[model samples]
Target: MDISINYTRGQDDPKSGPVKVGWVVSDVEAPVIYDPPRRVNSRDARREHGKSASRCPAVLGLESRYFEIACPFDINIGFDRDKDGRPHLRNLAGTSGPIRASTLGKRLSITNEAEWRYPDRPIIQLKLPYIFLADEPTYITQLDAYLHYRKTPLPGTIFGGRFPINLWPRPLMWAFEWHDVSKPITLRRGDPLFYCQFEFDNPERSVQLIEASMTPELKSYLEHISSAVNYVNQTFSLFDAAKRVRPQTLITPARS
Candidate 1:
């Protein structure tokens, strides 16, 4: 199964490969240490290999199935406020070109119609520019992209949500939400940003990701309803709006 990747941002950079296939050596020129989101690790063997959780098929299967999505840059964001008493967020550090952090506008509000804003915790969107989809649409009957954030060090702070990219055709983007705003949010380059897994309805199926070119027909297919959400409030209410604009039936999206 090939999940077509459009490197809208980092074209050849190894950090934003989006699919973790193998370990990234420490030789890459950078400052902070890069810890790969490997499914299994070969470390110090304290006990004899008689029985262990790591050796179990069921246990290793879960990790092996998931493809890791790594952060492309070293980003440091700090919370701040102005004299006017309105709070705000500032990007302290982020480099290596392409990857960036931005404040999510009011159009994409957390609530339906901004009835209740995100409190003092200003929401920031990680601008990870990459698009993924089951472009082949044959070997994989249905593709579901799930992004989870439990493996990272910042567990309770940075939030994770599922994105049905097969139907949506949106790029790889991240929303940052902090539990306790006291400490700043930081993610070093090559850090595990999200644990991405391509799922199918049948449990016996497996998947592999590959970069593919975006066809003109596929581009039109994606453009049909890609920006439709911005025209409305609350994504749940976009069914009617989507039908009006959706012009193609590339792959029937099972879930989002």
Candidate 2:
């Protein structure tokens, strides 16, 4: 069945277009940032320094409710992979509603997308901050941003440094990059920091859900990526909170 996916700057418009996000990845070339060793504070004033003064800043130390599980009319359409890379069920009559790895294809292309679209609700309200980036202020229509938000980082890591002509190697500060969230543009959240809303169709046809996480490794990656974006944004232009408040710069000429 064909599904109409609509993204809106505001909830009222259905033809606003689907939201999009961007993600970039290249083998193992992404940079990685790590903190230097912690500085040992002197417990006693009269004693000599226990260690040398060279060190980096110590690592700055650092839901939700519910929703329905829709039962699709045809469970076979829900997922399409079995252990032998085959279909386990012929129809929805006898199959369970919950999606399992066994019922998914070998590649992890879009298993979760089907699950998000079963209800046909047309107005799904997601109470999570799943949005990562956007091209427009009112709505999002970039799939890359969404995908970047969903991307997962692999385990291994590496660091980078500069090399000078005079010296074999030069001192370079640490920076971090992720194979997953490559280069995110902007991330926003409400004051409560707990809840946001997503509207899905009651008779949901097609959509996707990507969970935001605070996993130690994921957090580190996000922090580095965000910091990098902030650095760029700051260098290019000041973050004008006023623009958000007063977007209209069109001023009328004063009457003499």
Candidate 3:
């Protein structure tokens, strides 16, 4: 399975052939996927003659392949509430390096819906780049993106989402539910933000993450589906909007 990825700021063409494992025709930065690191086994926890979690297939699979998204820059997140108790979130830039994140790029905003779960709390959206496409027709796979909150357990916070990226080309706009508005939460540059895990329906096929340029047609379709949420209640229901706006001739058949 070759999953192609492209970002909004990426260039459409590259004169240099494909990048070694994948290709990303981006002028600024290509979205990065990493092998999630595992903690080293301490000698004290080792059983001389017994099986170890270090060698367990399930444990290995969890750390094998994933996109480890990081903080774009150092930023502090704080909460505010009005007289009516409607919540608002604010983001302040911390110490930045020579290359600062774009003011718009690092902005985190709270959801505006009044009836949403934990409406009095802040739900912050961290917009990410990289849209995905799987090129295999007979096999099926799944991609899920969520915060690595379990590994970095910050109390009073919820990861807020896990999206099945295989069905749509939507950007990974990560929403985090902050339950505690007491004090601010700060994130330094390079702090791990989330993880995107790709799963298999048919476990036999090998999967590859290839860097690819976004076609004009695909970008147009993405724009249409992404904008649809602004007009509807079920933001999650836009998987249908993806196919509705895409010409039938362009969709690749998936194993249904």
Off by over 4 Å in 2: 1-15, 26-132, 138-238, 241-256
- The local lDDT score (0 to 100) that residue 17 gets in candidate 3 is 24
lDDT of 1 by residue, 2-54 (tens): 99765343546533333311111211333143333333222342336657766
Worst window of 10 by summed lDDT in candidate 1: 136-145
* Index of the highest-lDDT prediction: 3
lDDT of each: 0.47, 0.24, 0.49
lDDT accuracy of residue 100 in candidate 2: 49
C-alpha TM-scores of all predictions: 0.59, 0.16, 0.61
lDDT of 3: 0.49
TM-score of 2: 0.16
lDDT score of residue 91 within candidate 3: 50
The reply for model 1, stretches above 4 Å from the true place, is: 1-50, 93-118, 135-156, 234-256
Alpha carbon lDDT at 254, candidate 1:
24
Candidate order by decreasing TM-score: 3, 1, 2
